[model samples]
Target: MKINDYLSHEELKRLISALLVVLGFISIAAFFGFTVVPGLRYQAYTTGESQVQAVQGETGWLDPTEYPVMAKEVIPPIDPKTVMTPNPALMARGKALFAQNCATCHGPEGLGDGAAGKGLTPHPRNFTANAGWKNGTKLEDIYKTLDEGIKGSSMVSYNYLPKKDRMALAHVVQSLGAFDHGASDPKALANLEKLFASAGEVIPNRIPVSRAVTVLCREYAEAHPQPTATTLR
Candidate 1:
């Protein structure tokens, strides 16, 4: 009121209008300073790259690569006696295979203390022990166990392994025991030799998981084509 008395009404109105203009400018400046400017500065400091496109194949999801077809072939006759002994090469291969496939249940040292066998009913076999093998500790017996697997146990058939590979594994299992693996029955040894000599093995055809997904997706798309604009109408 005193400021108004000092100035005329017209002058006071002009001052108030000028003050509002100053406040508006301050508000706009504050918004840019606190919000817009910081955002721009942060964007300038950013070092992130734009995402790359996903890989696409001929089937729109598969990578283009040649996958081998498993075909039928005659297995060359092998002497059982030759592979029954654990050679250095066979032991190395067996160790690798055991780690890959059997270690979850059989343990690294084949001591039957594997974590996966902790809850099983009849516990995994301890290869270090000379006794209590469901199948005898003979080379042939181990090979038979690998081929047929135990009926009421955690052991499953590894018959999918090649005959040579199974033989190598058998040798390695036998070697784990400190005691002597009793001699293989001569007739059983002869029979095992004959089985390899007489028969051929054929591995089933298979596809990679990625390739299978791609094929399934492609088939699904083909089977259920999308509705066109005209069709929707």
Candidate 2:
């Protein structure tokens, strides 16, 4: 009972053909599993990179800037009479200072239309108009406002500035309006003059935020040092 005895030649051929088909399918599967899939995997791991690299990669050093630290300085006493009215020299200095500091909130022409002032709650005071004077339009009043900032406003104390500079700024602020600025109160003017004549300002010391961070980090590292074998022993 050999296989040839039971099966015809045609049947043998069909059986051989079916085996060949099975073998062909196995060969194709092996090619993909062993060769093609591994090659594709190799290409992916070796050449391909994460898309996050494009966004997260830094081009240069990312050092943070040190915050400004004001130095302690003593300002000299100023004469109030000199700064009571806006002279050409005083106005020039005032204009320069305004451009440097106030222009961001107050417009170039003091229209309160400055870009920075737009987002302010009540908006910056419009110097061109005489309507809403927070401290009033008098020289002494404006001076007082500059020295002590408005309680509920974006205005901060300009007391950091010298009395002369603040007075000059007040004069410039007054000049912005075309309407008559009423006479300053006698008592207020007298008080301002006496203050200027008697007292001078002293700037306090300050430390930069970046420097402070560095100091804190150093202190922490010193306090909690990593243990080594020798230290453990």
Candidate 3:
């Protein structure tokens, strides 16, 4: 028998029914695409971006410049020499700051065993050990690390911190440095002297963190202005 003759009437009927069902689905989809979807898209086009933003503004959309800046703290004067001094008061302040911020990653003792620090690749610094740290353990190096964290690491920039807070944290980190051997290398102390003697300006910590972020953004923009695209001939 020929292929068509071999098929039973029931089989042919079922096949034709399946084809009709598929065609009905396609027709429904095409109708929705041309009509229903267009209606939805039309609603979106009716509102301009500015108009939408205006509505959002009424609903409490605020500009960054308008955000409430926190009250500034009156930070005491500190020079580079004072920074390295083993002041009990400074160490106490640093400890508090570390507990608030650094302890999350660096642990309570600055040992890099914080619960949050766990699972980070290359592991966090063990302040007790001070191994595999990118920045040296000197006062200036710690200050630099606080200002700009180690690149390609879990460390983040703490420059947003008030200058005094950063300095205090640096002192805390420096204090954590415990040499495995007898004494620190002379070269390290020499490096600290070279950097700390004139460690630029020790900015007052009167400004709050919120304001500091804005200031840093402005400074960065000034330093690295984007180049305008040139038209190709």
Candidate 4:
């Protein structure tokens, strides 16, 4: 029998219709499995994990207060006896250093009223007043301040200064009438002297302000001296 003769048209149509229905069901199942099911599962898993972590308090965030605070280093005191023999040379060097590095904020007389001082809060310490907020008038205290800066203040560490130079600066600061408003304290002076001695050899005079002054005076006198008149009889 021929194929067309054996199969009836109505029967063939029914078979085709059944095959299409099965393919349609397979396509719908495939779309759900590849797209919708995975997305729903992921959302549910993530939400559940987040909720569990919140309930357990296991979010892994650290508290700031858990860290320990460290204390500042303390500096040693100096012997007063050795630093009293005022080294004019060191003072002069320190004066120059102050002019270059400190005058802008501390003023020419260290009054803490320089042009820049107008803008600063808790205005720069008036060294002339010698009101040391950090306390301890020891030379080491000054040196430590120069080595390690004070926080929340304009006072910064001048670690770049050599030990001798720092000592000179301390001495210069001390000499500014701030440390000696009345009679010099014998003990304090002696301790300062000893501190200077311990800091190795004294700083030598390097600046020549006097020589410059002398030259200027000689030039001025030669150019504009008062004339002595000889009267003709």
Candidate whose TM-score is highest: 2
- What's the candidate order when arranged by decreasing TM-score? 2, 1, 3, 4
Segments of candidate 3 deviating more than 4 angstroms: 1-69, 72-77, 180-233
Which pairs, if any, clash in model 1? none
**lDDT value for candidate 2?**
0.64
Whichever of 1 and 2 has more TM-score, that candidate is 2
4-93 in candidate 2: lDDT tens per residue?
998876667667655665565566555544543321210010111111112111111121223245567677777767776667877876
Per-candidate clashes, comma-separated: 0, 0, 0, 14
Give the top-scoring candidate (lDDT): 2
RMSD of each: 23.5, 25.7, 20.4, 37.6
Model 2 vs. true fold: TM: 0.62
Model 4 segments more than 4 A misplaced: 1-85, 130-132, 178-233
Global lDDT scores for all candidate models: 0.61, 0.64, 0.53, 0.49
Model 1: residues with Cα > 4 Å off, grouped in runs: 1-75, 208-214, 217-221, 224-233
Per-residue lDDT of candidate 4, residues 1-233 (tens digit): 77668677665655665566556556655654454332221001111111211111110112011111122332344444333444766576666666645666677788887775667666777776756646344555555566565676656556544455566667676666545434445665555456544554322222122343345456644654433323111
lDDT of 1 by residue, 1-233 (tens): 68967997666666665566556556655554454332221001001122212212211111122232344444566665656566777677666666555565677789988766677768889999987989889878999998888887657666755677778778777777788888789888888888776666664544434354456556655664544445434
lDDT of 3 by residue, 1-233 (tens): 77579777666655665566556556655554454332221011111211211111110001111122234344444454655555776677677667655665567887878776676666778877856667776666677787777776657566555455566677787777676423445676465545545444332223322354456556655664433333111
Decide which is better by TM-score, 1 or 3. Answer: 1
Winner by lDDT between candidate 2 and candidate 1: 2
Taking all chains together, the TM-score of candidate 3 against the true structure is: 0.47
